[model samples]
Target: MTTADVRTVLTDGDLTVVGQIVHASNATLVCDAQVGDTVVRCVYKPVRGERPLWDFPEGTLAGREVASYLISEALGWDVVPLTVLRDGPYGPGMVQRWIDTVDPAESAAERLDLVDLCPAGSVAQGWLPVLRARDLDGDQVVLVHADDPRLQRMAVLDVVLNNADRKGGHVLEGLDGNVYGVDHGICLHQHDKLRTVLWGWSGEPVDPVLLADLDKLLRRFDGGFAEELHEHITGAEVRALQRRIGALLEHPVMPHPRGDRRIPWPAF
Candidate 1:
């Protein structure tokens, strides 16, 4: 289906819970939402199912997820999938289009190499080593990935949104060759809470394309983005988002991990 059709189905569809994601910390369900004649598979997170966070308030993760989508859309980056906050079988929560992921073993095998096996410059052509560690056998190994442009864009998105839970699993590569970010529940806070697993571009120059997108976002907020955002998040959080954009605009480079705990645990 076309993207517009998907958006319509996601925004104004008959949501039906098909199953539950048992591993999720919150109440997450798999749903088949009907829009006109089409049914779109969606991941639904209900507020009533939310587990309270120490830093963030209770039952507010759902709104944060939707707010992340709005900010992503405003930046003109398809970082997050089509998402919305609506009443469902359990209660009000965030519902997003589910992306079918490319097998990680397949995707990683093509881009990664064993540090001990590959020649010095053999893997450096377009691949960047991201992880160096010991495998289960206690052998030194390194993991590399293609310098994918989409992953770079997603890194920028995470920075702008102040995403706090950008786990490796959150970065999904679809069969259609598009990379999407999901599960942005504790984001856009008024503090410097940008924890993520996408620091491969750390210390590199920010591409002009990404800078331009940030500029566009600034203009949009100056126009009406802040006003619209207030519906989903607090006024303070909206200001925090603007502050993040301004910081990125001034830096114009990929940020390095600050302090000792900038990145998330279990980087994979």
Candidate 2:
């Protein structure tokens, strides 16, 4: 199908469930949806299926997912896939364009290289040391490619969304060789809850290109982007989203993890 067809399907498609994403914590369904004459694979996350979170209110995850996509598009990052909130087989939910990823493990491995141990300088030649551990048997450390511009944008996106659960598996490398983020159900809260695995750019200078994109988002927020989000999140959440954009524009630096719980459990 053409790009326009895919958009039409995701926008006003008749969904037919192909299977359930059994491993998903919440109810997630794999469906083949028809737009007019074209069918495209899509993922559905119904609001009723969301498990309650003490930090986030109920029935808001699906909206947050849609909000994240809007923010990504506003920033011109294109990190999140095309997503929309609409009625589904179960009820109102979020439907996203399906991204066919390469093996998750293989993609992860391609970005990381095993080293003997943490090296001096912490910052290597365009690479940054991610983690280091020592067992009785041996010592090991993993370094990630910090220079990858795509990942840098994703990190910025996580900060803007205040993403609370950016596990490794959520960072999918599509067959087209582009990275897309998924599972934004626990994102964009009014409070500070940015948990992510893309902290490789910590303490580094934010790229100029990213800063330019952020400026665009600020303009959008001032115009209608925040208003657009009212259909999904509360007024306070929308305000918080604006505040995050302002702060990032001012600082324009990879933030150091300050929260007590910086990384989400079960990182993968």
Candidate 3:
């Protein structure tokens, strides 16, 4: 189905819970969104199931997830999958199209993972090293991610959204050959809270094409896109997002980590 059709199903179709994503911190349910004959797999995070967060306001994660999708769409980058805010079986929440990732068993030869670990000092030619540490056996290993353009775009989106919890597991290698980011509940805060694992491009010059996209996004913000974002995030948060875009436009360089907590805990 086309993107529009899939979105319609997610918005209006009946959601039947199939199972729970037990690993998720919040209540994340796997469901089938069915509209007559068409059915699509989706993830439903009902607002009622949200866990309280000390930094972020209560029950606002769903909206932030949707807002992240909006920002990604405005940039014309498909870094995020189709996500929508709607009433579901439990309550109003965020629903998103589930991405089927490239199976490692099937694609091992190609090494499809965007983030990975390797023996210290043995980082692959095309991969960028992020951190070095000891493994369970006390042997040195390094954290690394691929130097791919798609992942770079995601890093840019993370900056714009001020994503606070971009763990390595949140990055998915979709079977369709696209890189996608997910679990954006703690994003778009009024204050700076950009935590991500896609910092491989840090301190590098921003791609000219992505800078152009940021320019377009700034124009949209002036054209009432900020108001639309206000429906999900706060007015101050919207303004903060604009400032982030403006700062990037002015500097046109990928940001370096600011503090010790730049990378989220449990990096995987």
The clash count of every prediction, one per candidate, is 0, 0, 0
| Residue 19 lDDT in candidate 3 | 98
lDDT of 1 by residue, 1-268 (tens): 8888988888789998899988677888999999778999999998999998889988889988999898888778888998999888887889999898756576656454211223333456666665565667776755454478888899888888888887776777777778889889989888888887677788998889889988888888878888888988899999888888888889888898787776666554
**For candidate 2, lDDT tens digit of each residue in 58-81?**
999999999999889877788999
Report the C-alpha lDDT of model 3 over 24-94, residue by residue, as the tens digit.
98999999999999999999999999999899999999999999999998888999999999998898999
Q: Top model by lDDT, which number?
A: 3
Pairs that clash in candidate 2: none
Return whichever of 2 and 3 wins on TM-score: 3
The candidate with the higher TM-score, 1 or 3, is: 3
Q: What is the C-alpha lDDT of each candidate?
A: 0.81, 0.81, 0.92
Say which prediction, candidate 1 or candidate 3, comes out ahead on lDDT: 3
Query: Cα RMSD to native, each candidate?
Result: 3.3, 3.5, 1.1
Top candidate by TM-score: 3
